[model samples]
Each structure stands twice: as C-alpha cells, then as structure tokens.
Target: MVLSSHARVITPVFSAVGGSGRSTVAGLLATGLAAMVPSVVLDLAPRLASPWPEWSSAPGAGLASIPPHMPLSRRQVHAAAGTNPAPAGAGWQVLTDHREWSAPPLAPVDAPAAWHQLAAVGGWQGVVADTAYPMAHDIVAARTAGRTGWTAAWCALPCSVPVVCTAATASGMQALQTALTAAAAEGLPVQRMVLALVSTGDGRLPAPVRAGETMLRPRVAAVVHVPYDPQIRAFGLRDATRLGARSLQASDLLVQAVLASAHASWGDPLPAAATPAALPPAHPSALPVPEKVSIP
Candidate 1:
C-alpha cells in the first residue's frame, strides 16, 4: 500500500504453511528494524502459542493495558513495552497475547482493531506482527497487508522457495498457489510480500532451487535469506544480540530488505527518526491504492 513517510507501518510475518519458522523471522525483523528505528513486535498468535515471553501479563500490560487509539509519545511506548538492548542499545519491545488464564481468548475478528489501538500508542517506527499460519479463513496476515502503511511477510524454509518453482506442476503447490491468489484477490497486494527464506545451515540454497527462486522473483517484493543458528531454536526466539555471527549477518540482511520494501511499497523512504505524532483516524481512505513499485 502507498503511504506517506509520516505514517506508521505495521507488517505481519506469516507462513504459507506451518513449520516455516514464521515467528523466528518475525522476531528477527522486529529486532532488526529496532536498530534503525523505535519498533515493537506484537505477537497475535494464541496465548499458549506465542513464542515471546508473557510480557503482557506484567503489571498493567496486555493489549487492554494500552489506551485505545490515543496518541502517545515515544517515552510512553518505551515505558509500556519496556526496553531491551539489541543492535547495541537500540530499544526494541514486544507485546504478547493476554496471559491471564481466566481472561477470555482474543477473538480473531477483533485483531485489526486491537492492532490499530496499539499503533495509536505512538513512538514506533514500525510494528512487526507474528501471525499464526493461515490454514483457515482468518487470513490475519492478508488483513494486515491490505491496510495502509502495512505489509505482509511470508516466511518459509529455504527449500520451500525452490520447491515452489520446481514443483509448480505438482499437486502440493495447488493449495499454496490458490491461497496466495485468493489473498491477493482479497487485497493482499504483491508489493507487500516479503518472501523470507530461512536457512538451517550455511545459508546456501541448491543451485536448482536458486534458479527456481529467480524464476519466482517477480512474485514477491523482496527475498531475504536467513542463516540458521541453533541459538534461535535453543532460546525460543531470543533477541538479535544473542545471535551468532553468521546468523546476525543474515538478520541484518533480512531487515535491510524489509526496510527497502517498505520504502518502495509505501512510496516513501523509512522515516529518518521516530516522532511522537497521533495516528491518523481510521477510514477507507487510509487503505493505500496498489502501485507498481519496483524492489531493488
């Protein structure tokens, strides 16, 4: 969607299918963006399924804890989400699902509204949301992508990208293709798809797979290759600072791609710095019209 540089961008990291390491990618993207700007990761998965710690359960935490649709300063966001040192003292924060066992689970339908409220809290350069795999009609990722100043990231194993190219004629890809087509038809624009390929080893795809990705390149806004590191799995998706050298480099590459995609997709560069401004009121006009923005 096309957004002015002043708008707050919210991106969702989702997988075409399960076991694609979507959450890991989302966390890395959030931490990476935090290095350049004030950013927050919002974990909207089911309570038990969220990978991040139950930070929302802390005193005065939870989505409800943040005032609804209010313009908050940068200090308020830092105080609410808490600060962590990553990318050398960059303030990255995370918010998770309501942790109270007695509390009713969040209704899927209310997700967009909840995210809107959180964005209104202000002081964020961007919000990276970790969405559950879309197996059902919820299509939360698509909903986020369709909004103005937002994008959707589809994470998958590195092998999966080649598989899409090599096995396009295979029946297995039918469901995935159909899903993607439907999402686009429903307003999930292609300019918003950050195709993140997570690698578990040396971060190299097979030659044939690489060619396949090249053939499929035009379908996505950008492709990021992430090296696999055990620490990511061991720590249950820790901060970027804890990543190893190769993994850290991969994270930086992925972040750079996302930022570039945001600039092109929104038709403006990433904001030079976070400013404390009120979020624009929600309306149909807020949805950006699709544009053919090229990704470098």
Candidate 2:
C-alpha cells in the first residue's frame, strides 16, 4: 500500500537511565496515531522487556520475533501473528532481540530497511519506534559503519519525522542536549529532534514546565507533555489501554500540528472516538484495580 503524504515515521531513542516512561510514551503515541491513520509501533529496545501475554491482552497488539541478522518481510510479519490480533487502523509489533544487547549490534542498514518494510505492510501512514536507552557503543559503532537507519526512517518525504526525547526533569533534558550535541558534531541531523516533556506527577505537565520546554526547544517539530497517569502501570496488569486515550489524543494533535507546520499532508482528520476493542473480560476477582499512586 502506498503511504499517505502525512505518513510520519519516528524512532524515539530513550536515555540509558530507563524507567523514565519512554515506552509508555511510545505506546501512547502509537495508539494515538492509529486512531487517525494506518500506523505501526515498533519496540526496538531489548532491555525494556514487554511480556507477550500483557501485550496480547491489548486489542490490535501483536508480537513479531524478528531475528537480529534477518530482514523482515510483510508476509513473514503477518505470518508471525498468534492468537493476539492487531488493533483497528494500526498494529503494534514488539520485535525482540533475544541476543545479548551488546552481542548483536544495531545494524544500521537493517534499521531503515525495517521502516521501509513496515511502510510496505498495511500501507502505513506513520511509524513510531521505541528505541533503547543508553544505546550500546557497538550500536553506535554500527551506525558509524554506514548504517543510516535512523536517518533514513525519519527523512522520508511527505512525512514529518520527529524524535521525541523524554526526560524526567530539566537536568535530564540538559544531559540529552549534551548527547544530541555530540551526535550533531558527529554529523547526525539535530534539526529533526523534538522534545516530549514527560511529567511524572498525576501525568499532567505543568504550564511552567511546558513553557520551559519551549524555551529550549531545538528545531522542535513540536513539544508534547505526557501527564503522569496511573493507567500506565496497568499496561501489563489489565486491559487499560483505553486509560491512555486522552494522552494519545493530545500526542496525536501535537504530531498533526508538527506535520502541518512542516508542510507535509496531515491526511484526513481522525475518526471520532475510535477506541480499540476491549480485552476479553478478565475475572474481576482475578485482577482488581489498584489504588492510584502519586506521580513521582
């Protein structure tokens, strides 16, 4: 299927210090986009492990066991589907690298090729990759060895590719800025970076912090703040995917605005209230809702 002019492929690389809610943001972004267009969410980080059963519980979520050395084909991916079904309008695939993180380097060539393959499947209009944090030096080395996967994935035309950098605090943002600066010095395009300020409290980003993000925005395609919501914890526990509907909505709006500002087509407006199918009703006694916890 041919991609729409609004097709946006993003690869969000989190910081090494994990637990900063990077995966949560990735999931929300993917779900949000799916509400609007055909999208694919790829989890590329090996360390942030997502259990298969939990993902399967969410409608439209599927797992694809992609070999590190092998390239995935649309048919191969479709064939990998098990009992879990894909969400409507989009699908989320968790690609695991069973090998040691350090053992299999991030093949630069495969990175971009994977995006192309995803676009080929289901005629994706957007692709969002949840990258691993503190990327191993070997991964960086592979990129240096002529792997432009990250660049190729986002640099596609008629698409607005933005890398959402999630930080716990301003200090974390500074450190990210430093690393991004170095990558720029090494010839990585810094202009494509967009900051997604994640608030750990009640999942709400304060106005002041939002303003602060704007102050430091770098060629910012758009700035998004993810409020600290308890439902994020439910990702593995229950079918709380709907809990993030609002967050996903906000994220989609930001992405749409970014694409429009870049002069790329924003495709058609999202369908009104397109919710993914709810997971089979679990025994209420089997899984009880947990008390809301304060955002850190």
Candidate 3:
C-alpha cells in the first residue's frame, strides 16, 4: 500500500558486529514505544539467536505466517500474532522465529517484504525489529551483490528509522566509528541513522566513548546513550517493566529521538480519511501488481 500518515513507524535495531547488545536495544525501543502507542517487535534475527520464544505463549506462529496483503489492519495483525483471543495489552506483540533453526522457510531471505507489509499495518505507530546478525556488513553485501535482503538504507522511508547499536568501551567505539564510515561510503543512509551507545559497565563515561560520541554525532540523526541496568545483568530483558528508573527513562528518550528524527526527516502531514484515488475494479482471475518504486 502507498505510505501515508496513518502507517506504522518501522524501527530496525542493528549492530556492526556481535556483542553489541542489539537485542537489548530492540526490546527497550519496542517496550518504550508501547508506553504511548500499541507497538510490535519483529525479531528478524535467526531462529537460533532469537530471545523472544521463551516469552511468547503462542507457537507455530511467526514470520512465515504473516499475511502478505498490501495493508494489514490492527485487528488482523493481532489475530495473526495471537491465539483465538488476542493477548490483553495496550503494550506490544512480538513476532519471532518459531521453527527449527536449520530448517526450510528461511526468514531473512525475504525480510524486506515482511518489513514493508508490517509497516503498512494500520492502528499502530511503531515496529521495532531486531535485525539479523552482522547487520552493517551483511546489508551492504546484499545490496552490493544485487540481492534484496532487508537493508536499512532502502527501508528508511518517511515512516522508518534505522538504528545502529554499539557498546561504550574504547574498542567498541572504534568499531562503530569504522562501521559508520564504511556504511556511509556505500550509500547506506548513515546521515539519517540512529546511533545507540550502550554501557555495560557502570561509571563515568570512558574517555574513548566521550570522544567517539563527539566525533560521531554529526553523521547520524540522533545518538542515544543507554546506561547499564542491573536487572539486565542479573536476569535478562524478560521483565522490561522491572527495569531501573534510569534505564526506563533512557528507553523513553530513545523513543522520543526516533519520533523526533522521523518528524524532522518527513514533515508532518494530516492523516488521510480515505484513499486519494479510485481503485480498479476487482476480478476473480486478476493478479496483484508488484509494488515497486525507484527510491533515487
């Protein structure tokens, strides 16, 4: 479907490499966005690496089950994500890998179409996707090779914001710096990307991190520093509602930055009440036309 003001906002959390706290940032963003708008989390990561299955009650329901229609309504999405009766919450729904890790029906192969369909889902404002591993390198490689995996660059439409995650240590900072430079060189919308600086060790900011933040600020739309949370260290993100005050506040700040960035990138437009043009008459044997656009 054509994008409009009523479409959901898509936020894909990514990282240059592993050990970057990608999943943690994704959970925080989804839960934080849920505080205001009913949101959904799409765990586009591989089945073996996904962290959401233990938390989700539903089984045999995941990426493959998602409807590929042009647009999805809120109720339709919830039904897809839930059982006969949808989960009770104004919070969020999680869609992750539910099949065997090394089985057929690979998800990442068709990631972009899933993303586009979900973004067109009505009745929500956000979708925080935990992208696959080595997001920075893999996406560039896919695009460079003429394959159409879910590259954050192409998906950074007016309603979408791609976020890159990194740790706060010296080496971590350097890795992220290198990644941004390389991705920017490849035309991956680095200027509009969101940088998430996560701190796993508690204390005053490290010198390298401070310097890195200063150096990296201009290249991205917004930079968010997520402080270390004790609960996450003790347990996991299984209970986000129990996060410390500071961590919770950081999540909210991240949501605000995403919304603000989207607004700045795409000027506010009044929500349309109906389709702007008349649709062609439908026929039983008619085939659906492929949606395509030359972004450049």
Clashes per candidate, residues 3 or more apart or on different chains: 0, 9, 0
lDDT at 124, model 2: 50
Runs off by more than 4 Å, candidate 2: 1-17, 47-53, 58-75, 81-110, 135-160, 203-212, 236-241, 244-246, 261-296
* Cα lDDT for residue 131, candidate 2: 62
- In model 1, which regions exceed 4 Å deviation? 1-7, 54-60, 67-79, 98-109, 135-178, 185-187, 201-211, 270-296
CA lDDT scores, all candidates in order:
0.55, 0.49, 0.68
The lDDT ranking, best first, is 3, 1, 2
TM-score leaderboard ranking: 3, 1, 2
Candidate RMSDs in order: 12.7, 14.6, 8.4
TM-score of each: 0.67, 0.62, 0.77
Span of 10 residues, lowest total lDDT, candidate 2: 270-279
Which residue pairs show collisions in model 2? 7-125, 16-134, 60-86, 60-87, 202-228, 203-227, 203-228, 204-227, 204-228
lDDT of model 1, residue 216: 47
Candidate 3 segments exceeding 4 Å error? 1-7, 57-60, 64-76, 82-89, 99-109, 143-149, 152-154, 269-296
Tens-digit lDDT track of model 3 for 170-237: 88888888778767766777766789999978898899999989988987899999999888777666
Cα miss at 272, model 2 (Å)?
26
